[model samples]
Target chain A: MLSKSAARAFFLSGTLLFGAVFIWLTVDTFQRIPAQTNAGDLNESVVRGKHIWEENNCMGCHTLLGEGAYYAPELTRVYDRRGPAFIAAMLKDPEAVYPGQRRMVKYDFNEEQISDMIAFFEWIGRMDLNGFPPEPTIGMAAAAIAIPGGERPQVFTQICTACHSLGGVGGTIGPALDGVGDRFDRGYLMRWITDPQAVKPGTQMPKLELTEEQRNEVVIFLSKQREAGL
Target chain B: MKYQSQKVAYWFFATCMLLLSLQLIMAFAHSGFDVLHPWIPFNVARASHNNLLVMWLLAGFMGAAYFIIPDECERPLYWPRLAYVQLIALVVVGVTAIIGFHFGWWEGRKFLEIPRPLDYLVVVDVLLFVANIGMTIWKAPKMTTTSIVLFFGLLMAALLYLPGMIPTDHQTHDAFWRWWVVHLWVEGVWELIMGAILAYLLIRLTGVDREIVEKWLYVIVGFTFLSGILGTGHHYYFIGTPSYWLWIGGIFSALEPLAFLGMAIYGVALAKKGGRNHPNRMALFWTVGCCIMSFVGAGLLGFAHTLPQVNLFTHGTLVTAMHGHMAFWGAYAMLVLAIMTYALPLLTGRKLFDTPSASYAFWSTNIGMVCMTVAFGVAGVAQVYLERRAGMEFLDVQRELKVHFIGLILAASLFTSGIIAFIYNFIRYGLPVGEVEESVSAGAAAAAPAE
Candidate 1:
C-alpha cells in the first residue's frame, strides 16, 4: 500500500491545485458579465417577474437560458419571436392561443403579473448569450409578401399567421395558405375567413369578425395567392 | 454477518431498492405516460425522480460503509443502534422532501431542489451518519487503508454540501454554487468512495495482497482528485460563467477520463493477477463490470460533451440524460450491487452467485442500460440538429422525439426486470443470520497470493 505520508501529500497537492484553479475560474466568471447585462439589477418588475417564474416553476416545462426542461421550447429568445403583447395575450388565455398541449400549464396571472413576466423575458432577451438557440428560419426571409392593399399584409401579419403558414413561413397550428386561391373561390374564402366555425364546427380558428368591406378585401387578397413559383 | 450491527445494512439496502422503484414510477409520471396519476405533472415528478435517485444512492453508500467498516477494522461497530436512527432519519427527510415538492415548497434549483428548511434537516441527517462512521474508525483497534479512505470520502462529502447552501439571488451565482455541490460530489468525492469500495472488494474477492490492491487505490485517488476538482469548470462554461472556462473546462474535464481509465485498468489487472478462485464469481463480474462501464459512461460519454463547442448544442438535452443513466448506473449503482453481491452471501449464509438468475441479473441490467443509452443518444442528436441547428420550435422537436420515448420505455422495462430479479434474490436470502465462519476467515488469509 502507499505509505500514509505519500497518500496525504498526493491528496493535499491535488486538492490545493484544483481549488486554486476553481477559485480563479469563479473570479473570472464574476467579472465576465457587465453589471448592466447580468441578472442582478432586481428592478421592481424584474424582481417580481423572477419570483413569478420561481413561484409558478415555469422552468419545469420551459427552459430559460437553456437551463430548464427540454419538453417546452427554449424561451431564451421568446421576446424576439412572440412580442410582449402576444405573450401577454397568450398568458391571458392560453387555450385560445394554441390548444391540445399538455405542456405549459396556464395559471391565472393578473395584468401586473403578466407584465412582470413580459419584463423578465425582455431582460433575458437582452443577455449577451453567444448565438444560442439559433434564430428561427420562418418569417426571417427578408422579402415581405406582395399585397393588393397595405392592410392585407398587416392583417395577415397581425392575426392570420399566428395559426396559419403562408408560403411555408408561419406557425403550424393551421393549414398552409400557399395554394388557397386555387383551392377556394372568393365566396368560399369570404365565408371561411369571416366565420370559420360556421362552416367547420369544432375548428380551433375563432371568428375574424371583419366588416363586409374588409371581408371582401381579405377574400380578394387570399384568392390571389397561387403556388409560389406558379 | 460478521457483526450483529451489519444486519442494519440490509434494511438500508431494502430502502435503496424501494426508493429506486419509486424513482422509476415517477419517471413515467414526469413523462405523462402514467394512466394512474396523469395529474402528477412534470415539475413534481421530475423533482421526485431526481431527488429519489440521490437519496437512494446516499442510502446505498451508507449501507456499504456500515457493512465494510467493521470487517476492515477487525472489530464490532462503534454504535450499532445509532446506524438505525440515522437510516430512519434519512428516510423521513427523503419522504418529506418528496411530499414537499408536490406542494411547490421546493427551492426550484435542479438536483438541490429541497427547500432551505429541509436542506438543514438533510445536513443534520448527514452529520449523524458521518459521526457514526467517524467514531467507528476512531475506536477500532486497527484501521485499514480502506476504512480511512472511505471515512475521508464521507467527511469531505458532508463538508461539500455546505457550498450549495450559500445564499444567492443572482441566477448565475446560484448556478455557480449549485454545481459546487452537484459536480464536486459526483466527479470528486464520490470517486474516492468508489475507489475505496473497489479496493475493499478486490482485496477480499481477488485474494490479492491488501498492499498491492491499496497501492493502486492511491493511484486512483490521485487521478480522481487531480482531474475531477478542476473539471468543475465544464459546468461553468456558458452558464453565464467566464469565457475562459471554455478553455479551462475543456482542457481539465478532458483529462477527467484518465481517472476512470485508471480504475478500469486497476480492476481488470487485479482480477487477472489474482487467481480465478473466488467462489462468488458474480461479485467479481459486477466489480470489474462497474470499472469498465464507468470508463465508458463517465469517462468516454462525459468527454463527448465536455468541450464548450459541443456542450453549446448538447447541454440539457437528452444527451445529458444518456450520459447520466449509464454513468450513475455503472459507477455508483453497480458499486453498491457489487458490495451487496459479495456481502449478501456472507450476510445471509447463502451462496446464490452461481445461480442462473444471478448471471441473468448482471447481463440483463447492463444490456438494458446500454440500449437505453443508445435510444437517448439518437433522440439527443436529432434534437440538437433540429431544435438547435435548424431552429425548429422547442415543442415541435419534442413532438418528433416522442417516438423515442417508446424505445426508452421498452428498455427501462427490461432494466426494471433485472432489478426485480436482483431484489428477489436479496429477499430470498432471507436477511442476515449466523456468525462469520472460521473456515472462511482462514481461507481469506491463506489465499492471499501476493502476500
Candidate 2:
C-alpha cells in the first residue's frame, strides 16, 4: 500500500513533467507556421477572390496546409504545375479542368477575382517546406527507344537505373517504371514525359529535360522488359 | 433436475476455463517460439487473450453464482437442468472462439470481436444465466445477498454486448461504441458483480458483520457505476474524434478510477483490522489482493493514459498491456479465484488443501504481477523518452527495445507457474469435500508408513 504522502509526491512529479511537455509541444505546433495574414497586400483581383473564398468557405470542402475538413482535394501546390490562364478559365467554368467531371461550382466572380485566385494559389506554391518529403525525380530518362535494332538497354542501365529498379540490385527509392511504356501509347507517353505531374494530377514526380531521342530509347527499353516478362 | 445438475455444471465450467487457459497459452507460447506454429496460428494473440479471459470469467461467475445464489435466496435450484445445456453451448462457443482467435480469423476490434456466429453462442449462454438468476431471484424475493450482485452484472454483460454486435458502416461510430462495450462495462457495470461477490465473500470468510461488508459493497458498486459510465470519456480523447470530446473525456475519466483505488485501500484496511483466523485462506488471499490491484493497476496506470497528451505516447505500448494484466487479474481473476477457493472445497469436500498453498501462490502471483507492472512502466517510460526526446522513428524504438520486453514475458511465465503449483495443491486437497473418515486400529498401522 502506498503511504498518502508518497502517493501525493508521485502525483506532483507526474503533473510537473506532463505540464512541461504539453507546453513545449503546444508552443512548437504554434510556431511552425506564422499566423500573419497577407490580406494587407491584396490587389483588386485578390480582394475579389478573397470575397469568393469567404462567401463559399472553401475550407469547408478542401484542405489547405493540412487544416480544414478533408472532404475535397488539397490545393496548396496546384498553381506551380498549372497555368494562370488555365486556372482562371477553370474558375469561370470549372468543367474545363476535366470535361464532364464534377468540380467546384462556377461562382459568379469577375475576371479579376479569377486572377486573384490564381495569385492565391501561386502564393500557396511559394511556401517552403524543408525537405520533409523528398522530391520525386522521374520522366527524364537519358535513354530512349530505338526504332529498330537499338541498344536502349545500355543507356537505361547507366542513367534511369539509378533511382528506380525492377526485381533486383539498384536504388529502389523511386517508383519502378520498368514497363510503363506498355501502359501508354506514344502520344500519351509524350505528354507524360514532357512534364510528368501535369498528366497525373498531384503526382510528386518531377519533370526534367530529355532529348526526343533519349525519351524514345527509354520508352523502347521499358517496353522490352514487359515483353520479356510476359 | 436443476439442483442435481448445478454441481455438474460447475465441473463443466472448471474444465472450460482450464481448457481456454491452455488454448491461450498455446497461442502465446507458439508465437513465442522460433519455429512451428501452435494448434491455432496467426496474429490473433490479442484476441485470444481477451476472449479467453472473458469466457473463463463468465464460466467462473456462472459456477460461483450457482452455489452462492441458491444459498442466498434460500431455495432449491431454479432449472438446474438448463445449466448443463448452457455449459455445453458456452464451451462450444468458447472453444470455437479461442480457435478462431488463434487462427487470425478475427477483425481487430479490441473488446468485441469474436467472429459473428460464435458470439451468438456466448449471448445465448449469458441470456440463460440471466434468466435463471432472474427467475430464481423473483421466486425467492428479498434474496438480496452477495449473490444478487451478479444478477445486475450478468444483465449488464448482455446489455453492454448489444452495442458491440451492431456493425455500422461509419467506422467512427463503430469505434465509439467499441469503447462503450470495452471501457464502459469494465469500468461501470462489471464492478457491480465484483462488488457483490467481494463483499459477500469477505463477510462469509471473515466472520465479520454482514452489515459492514454489504455496506461497503453497495458503496463500491455505486462508485464504480457512477464513475464507470463517464470513464469511457478517456478513450474518446484521441480516436480521431472531434475536439469536443476532450473536455467530456478528461474530467470524468480522472474521476473514474479513484473509486476503485479507494475500494482497494479500504478493503485492505478492513482485512487488516479484522485480523486472522480466516477459514478459506486462499479465498482471503485472492479477495484482498484483487481489492488492492484493481485500484492501482486499473485505476492509477490507466489514469496516466486517459489524458490525450500521454495517450499519444503510451497508447499501443507495453504500458497498456501492463495495466490490463494487473487490472484484469486483480478485478476479475482474483475475484474468480476467491469464488473458486470457496466452491472448489464445497464440491470436493476438502478444507486444508487451500490453507497451506495460499501463502506460496499469493507470493508467486503478486511477485510476478508487481514485476510485470514495473517492467512495463519502465519500458513505457523508456519508449516515451525515445519517441519524444530522441525523435527516433516508432519502428526504430520497437527494434531497440525488443530485448527489454522479455521481462514482461518472463513475469507472465512466473505468474503461470504459481497458478500451476496452487492448482496442484488445490486438487490434491480440495477435491472430495466431506467429513473426514476415522480409521480402524488395524488400518492405522499401515497409514503410518504412507505418511
Candidate 3:
C-alpha cells in the first residue's frame, strides 16, 4: 500500500535527524559546564551525613528529590520540613508512630552523624530551590500563635484535611493525630508548624498552607479536641 | 446565534475551556522540573494533564456536535437542552476533578486521573454524546464534510480512553495502559479531530474540492493512528519495562513524526493545489502551525529519548516536558483555534475576522509557542546533563543553573501571554462584533512541489 520512495525518504530523514541532533546535543553537553562535580565534597557534615544516610539507606523508603525509590515519601524537603527530635525518635522507635509499616531497622547512627544528618537536611531546606515550595514565599513572621477558638476545626478541614483526619472523616493516606496534644507540647507544635524539620526531621507530611494565625488556631483546635469528654 | 438550540453547549464548553487553560497555566508555573516538588508530584501533574485534556476534548467535541450535528441530521441538535446538560455536567465534573487533583485526592496515573467517583459521570457524558452523534449521523439524509471527521474522532476517543482505566499495580503497567488513553487520544483519535476541523475550515474558506480534501483526510490520518498509537511504547522504554519495547517504540515513534511531517507538507500542498484567495487568515495559521508543531515537538524531541538507552539518559528531564508542552498545547489546543476560526465566521454573519488584529494574535501565539518550546527544551537538556547523567545533587544543580532556569521561567510566562493573546483575538473577531476593512492574509501559495 505504501510507496518505496516514501519509505526510503522516511529512513533518510530519520538518519539525518538522528545524526545531527545527537551530535549537536553531545557537543553542546561537553561545551556546557562539566556535568557534575566529584561526589567527594569533603565537608564534615556532608560526609558524616552521607555515611548515615547511606548506612540507613534512606532510599529504601523516601526519595531524594525525584530520584531513588518511591516506597517512602520524599526526603528532599526533609530538613526544613522535619525536626531533629522527630527523626531521632523515629529512628529510636520504628513502630512508635508507624506501627503499620515494615518495622524500620534500627541503624546504629552515632550522635555526630545524627547531627550531620540534621545538618544535611538543614542545608537542603535552606537551599534556594525554585519550582518547589507550594506557595514559594519565605515566611514573613509566625502569624500563627496560641489561639483559642471553635472555628479552628473548620479551618483545619479547609486546609489540613487534605492529609489529616478530622473526626475520622478525612483520608488516612496520612497519620491520625486524634490525641497528639497528650504527647506533643506547644513547642513541638510550633516547630512542626514552622518547619517540621525543626522538630522531627524527614517526616512525609508536606508543609501545610498555614498562616501563623491559621496554624495556631488549627493547632489549638487539634490540641483541644481530645475525645468529646476526655 | 442562539438559534434556539446550540447556545447552551457552546457557552458551557467555552467556559470550561477558559477555566482549564487557567489551571494548565498555573500548573506550568509551579511544575518546576521534577516529580518531587514540595507541592505537587507526578500524581498531580498526571491529573492536571489528564483532566485538562479531558475538559478540552469534551468542549471541542461538544462544539463540533453543535455546529455540524444539525446539518448531518437535517435538523437542529437533537434535544439541544440535553446537550446543554452534558456541557454543564462536563464543567462540574471537570472542575471538581481538577480541584481534587490540585487539592491532592487523585489517582496516581499519568493520564487516567479522573476521580474514581466521577468516572461514572464521564461515562454518562460520553454515552449521552455517542447516542446523539450516532443518531444524528444515522438519521441524516447525508453527513456533511466536517461531521464525518469529527463524529469519528470524538466518538473513537471515548472508546480509546477506556484501556487506561484498568486497575494496575505496577507504575509501568499503569503507564502502559495510560498511554492507551493519552497517546491514542492525542495522536490516534484527535488527528481526525484536527483533520476534520482543517477540512471544514478549508472548505468554508478555500473553495477546495471536498472530495479531494476528504481523500487526503482518508489517507493522511490512517497512517498517523496506525503508527501513532503503537508509538506510545516509546514512553515505557526506561520505566523498567520489557526490552523489546526499545526497538518497537523507537521505530514507531520515529515513524509517528513522519506522519505529521507528511501531513504538514501535504496540508500546505493541498491548500495550494486546492487554491484559496481569502482573508481571515488565522484559520489557516492555526492549521499550519498545528502540523509544524506536531512534527517538531512530538517527532523531533520525542525521538531524542525514546529508546531505553536514550531514556535512561533523558527520562524525567525537562526535555520530555518540552516535547509534551509543545505537542499538547501546540498541536491540539491550536487545532481548537482552527476549529474556532471556521465556526466563528459561520456563526457570525461576518465572512472573516478583521485581518490585522488576527495577525497580531497569530504572531503572538506562534512566537510565544516557539519561545516556550525552545526555552523548555534547552533548560531540560541542561537539567539532564546536570542531574540525571551527571549525578549532581539537586541543590548543587540548582545553585549552578538558577539564573538560566529563571530566564526559562520568564520565557514560559511569555508563552502564557501568547496563549492569552490567542484567546483575546478569538474573542474579539470570532464574537459578533461590528468590524472594519483591511484583512491580513498569509501567502497560501502552495508548498512548492509536494514531493
Q: Candidate 1: RMSD over Cα atoms?
A: 3.9
Residue A21 shift from truth in candidate 1, angstroms = 2.1
Q: Residue A127 of candidate 1: its Cα lDDT?
A: 72
What fraction of the true interface does each of the listed models get right, in terms of native contacts kept? 0.32, 0.00, 0.00
Off by over 4 Å in 1: A1-8, A34-36, A89-93, A135-164, A169-171, A179-201, A206-230, B32-38, B434-450
lDDT of 2 at B262: 65
Q: Which stretches of candidate 3 lie over 4 Å from their true place?
A: A1-230, B1-9, B28-46, B71-74, B144-146, B350-352, B429-451
In model 1, what is the error at residue B137, expressed in angstroms? 1.3
DockQ of all candidate complexes: 0.36, 0.03, 0.02
What tens digits encode model 2's per-residue C-alpha lDDT throughout B1-451? 1133346534654664486457447535532232332332223444565677787787877777776676566565678788777778887887787676544455445556577777776777889878987887889855664666668777987887877887643223445667667876787667878887776666555655655665566656655655556556566544334444456567767777867876787677767766446556677778888888888778887787777656544544556656777888788878887777655655554555355466777788788878878876777677656543443333344545656568767886777767776666555653342332222112212211211
Clashing pairs in 1: none
lDDT of 3 at B389: 45
Per-residue lDDT of model 1, residues B14-131, tens digit only: 8998998899888766653434333666777887888999999999999999988987776777888999999999999999989988887887777888888888988888888889
lDDT of 1 by residue, A1-230 (tens): 45756866887788788788777767766776655256555568976787788776666666777776656666776787666756776787766667664445567999999999888888777776654555534335422555322344445654566667665555567777777888888888887877788989998876654557656766777888866535
Q: Which residues of candidate 2, in runs, are more than 4 Å off?
A: A1-230, B1-9, B23-27, B30-42, B102-104, B353-356, B429-451
**Using lDDT as the measure, which candidate wins?**
1
lDDT of 3 by residue, B1-451 (tens): 3244544434644664586576556557344454244455444554565567757756875776676566434555666677777777877888798788766455544455566678878878887877777776777687765577678777887787677667643333444566667776776778777777766666545657666565666566656765665576565454334445567667777777766776777667756765555565667777777767767776666666665566655554556667777777666777666666655654544564656656666676667767777776776677666555443333344445556556666666666666666566556644443331113111221211122
- In candidate 3 the C-alpha lDDT for residue B171 amounts to 30
Each model's TM-score?
Answer: 0.89, 0.63, 0.63
Task: Please tell me which predicted candidate would have the highest DockQ against the true structure.
Answer: 1
